[model samples]
Target: MSVLSEYYAALERLKANKPIILPKGSAINNDTVAMEAGRKRGSIKKSRHAALIEAIEQAAQATGQNVPSPAQRIEQAKTKTKAVKSDYEQLKEDYEKLLEKVNSLLLENFELKQKRI
Candidate 1:
């Protein structure tokens, strides 16, 4: 089969969640479609296959396959990391406060025992 036909078939298979080569529930993007078509990951280049690329993009949009770009993924990761760090800091503060309270209670208990001796 021609490369274009192969890609289109792969796209259909992906849309139907029945790809032969890729895992089930694979996202409908250029790379997944290319790999499903038995081609390399970056085989569907815009310079070489502009129409195919456009078709894949349109299909992905139509099917609601909104895969994030690398930059978008990185930004999402950064936001998650920031939130995690903030939570960690809050936990650390709470731990320190608890530790201080425990120490104070221990000291008071020791003083009480000494007075009863």
Candidate 2:
């Protein structure tokens, strides 16, 4: 794998492990403070990984490596965002449909009992 890919993978691994945060307005020893700082730095590193990967990919493209076009990159990001939105919408629709079905079943049972009486 490329250097950028390796770095991105490492960041992903780090993100999988929760970062420690110091409680607000809490007193901490020097050791604890340093540890908190390290965790914060790691969080920043993880957040920047995507941007760094994009930059590296761009650089590779400039150097005639196999990299996606600028249009392709934009499209890929948009596609990902659209997919997430679509999934959310589908979930919402399914929930509504289930709720409607339950309500209809309840009404039907209620009506059937009144007719029998």
Give per-candidate clash totals.
0, 0
Sum up the clashes in candidate 2.
0
Can you give the lDDT of residue 108 in candidate 1?
Answer: 100
> TM-scores of the models, in the given order?
0.58, 0.37
CA lDDT, every prediction? 0.91, 0.55
Best by lDDT: 1
- Model 2, 1-117: lDDT tens per residue? 654454444333333333245444322222223244443323324364557545445544554546557799899999999999999999999999999999999999999999999
The stretch of ten residues in a row with the least summed lDDT in candidate 2 is 25-34
